[model samples]
Target chain A: MPEPIDFYFDFSSPYSYVAANLIDALADRHIRSVTWRPILLGPVFEVSGNRPLNAQPMKGDYMRHDVPRLCRRHGIPFAWPEPFPIATVAAARAVYALWDQDAEQAIRFAKAVFRAYFANGRNIGETDGVLAVAADEGIDAAALGQAIQDPAIKARTKAAVDHAIKLKVCGAPFFLVDEEPFWGVDRLPLMDEWMARGGW
Target chain B: MPEPIDFYFDFSSPYSYVAANLIDALADRHIRSVTWRPILLGPVFEVSGNRPLNAQPMKGDYMRHDVPRLCRRHGIPFAWPEPFPIATVAAARAVYALWDQDAEQAIRFAKAVFRAYFANGRNIGETDGVLAVAADEGIDAAALGQAIQDPAIKARTKAAVDHAIKLKVCGAPFFLVDEEPFWGVDRLPLMDEWMARGGW
Candidate 1:
């Protein structure tokens, strides 16, 4: 069996939201499993001298228009969050906490958080909002909130970002198929071809 | 008939090189023509606070690897120039000059210049290099040199860049189909689909 593809993403990234919608079906088509890893792009961007996509000047303007058009093309639900690019630290911590207990539940929790921010326009930056998302996924809101504040879970979230940075993942929706790094949801087709053909 | 798709590019961009190889055929398939506009990205990048892909740290590292890999996927020939990202002022001026004389010859000249820099690793920055590329395309080197130096042709090049800026073109290999903007070579597929479907 082939190694499961690693998907690294940030909760606040629109491109990551697009990838989250498609990656599972894409992986299933190849008869492969996917490992979703929620990462904090704040520290990574700091070290790389990059800003959030919507924070950059013209790029921000372009993305504001492009993201929804892309969602339409892909047939995915999309709604711009009211306060764009809200901090995802609490969301990342919650994902890590759930991941320790159940990887599948963690994925469910991550999708819920993405939908809350990108589909429902809810701010995932707040602990309460994230707790609500966790609750929707059948996780205990109070326990998840406590776990998010736990030092071990906090360290795990930090470690995930650190690991992504070390791997030179400067962008969200990054995928790694046995160490071959492919960045962006735009690269998904190429990643699919790479897996299908066993590296052309 | 649909408006000709506007292909705005910079000579120094690797993605532009990739797009240059494919745009014409893509247009032909859709029964549409392309208006190839060579625009300088220097001023656009400055105003938009953008840098060359290879100038950013981690993105630079990734692009150095990604460009060649992308070339292979598209079955296009690519060779990184010795002095990558050479100033394209002379090349752009020369292309504009030839464009005034003969549009077909101008495209031939532009493609030759792209091949010289990207496939042969030749420097198109120097006046002599661009002159040689023009000569290879059946243009007179000395006459082309004089035309490149002509104030009118220089203004044309500047005007092209200015016009692109007015259109909010912040990146190279930007495409405009019926006034809708699509940025990046990765977007070529989307652009193609948009043309085919008459908006999706």
Candidate 2:
């Protein structure tokens, strides 16, 4: 592996789920390494002046048509999880809690959240659904939620968003390999080449 | 059509070309309407702090893998247009200027610009190239450039960016139907559905 890959994802993004499914395969074949990073999107948006894609008439129009086709093409399960545009605050915080303990489980929790929102039509912002996601990952939901609520963990999650702003990130489903940041799932191939060229 | 579908686009983006090509076909089948728009992406990035996909490492990785595959799947001609990241100022300005005189010509000019950058590997920001693009669309390139540079036109272009920010848009190849926004070409199908539902 030339360098380890850093994947900065948010639980609320459908494209992030699509990207997550391919990360391992990408790492194994291209860089031979990968890291899971779940960050809060709210702060990133604040700094970037971006609201949810649905809030923008044109962008929301695109997502309705494109996402499902991608899911079908990838052979991955997908749907517009209910309560269109579920809040991601709690979900992002939970990810902050899961980071250090186990990376694989973090991915599991992340995918479950994606499945909940984009595929299953569940409200990810609520306690029960999120806890259900954690439990599905075999995580101690109560404990993890407790851990996340810790002031330090909460602050760290905020910092992630702040960092994303400082880094000038524009949208969800972003990736970075060796300091080079790739912004969307659509940019996957470009990142691969940069890696093949040994990711500058 | 319940009402005219407002299509938001930047002449500098190749994805818009890809979307524009077949979008008409899809709209015809779904009985939707499309109104072309020309917006400036540079200003959108300026306010949003969003960098190109290649600038983000992870996103760049994804792009390396996905873009070519998408091009192949869509049967749309594509390549990494040279001046890898060309300055799109003039390209966008030209389309905006032409829009006032002939909207269809504006679309043609936009496509020609994409073909130049993505297919011919030309520099879109260059004056000569931009003029050539106008000529290709049977318009007076020099005249168009001068017209867009006028105070009112310049302000109008800037206003479009401001409006996009107000709507919380940070990226290109955007579309809006019935006041709903979709951000990328990938979202065209979703736009189609929304338009269909609106009786477009």
Assess every candidate by TM-score.
0.98, 0.59
**Residue B136 alpha-carbon offset, candidate 2, angstroms:** 11
Can you list each candidate's DockQ? 0.71, 0.09
Q: Looking at candidate 2, what is the lDDT of residue A65?
A: 59
Best by DockQ: 1
Tens-place lDDT digits, model 1, residues B85-196? 8889999988788776787788888888898999998899899999988777778999989988999999888998998898889799999999999999988888989988
Highest lDDT against the true fold, candidate: 1
Worst 10 residues of 2 chain A by lDDT: A54-63
Docking class of 1: medium
What is the Cα-based lDDT of residue A39 in candidate 1?
A: 85
Q: What share of the true interface contacts does each candidate keep?
A: 0.51, 0.02
lDDT score for residue A180 of model 2: 71
Measured against the true chain A, the candidates' chain A TM-scores are 0.97, 0.90
Residue B56's lDDT in candidate 2: 57
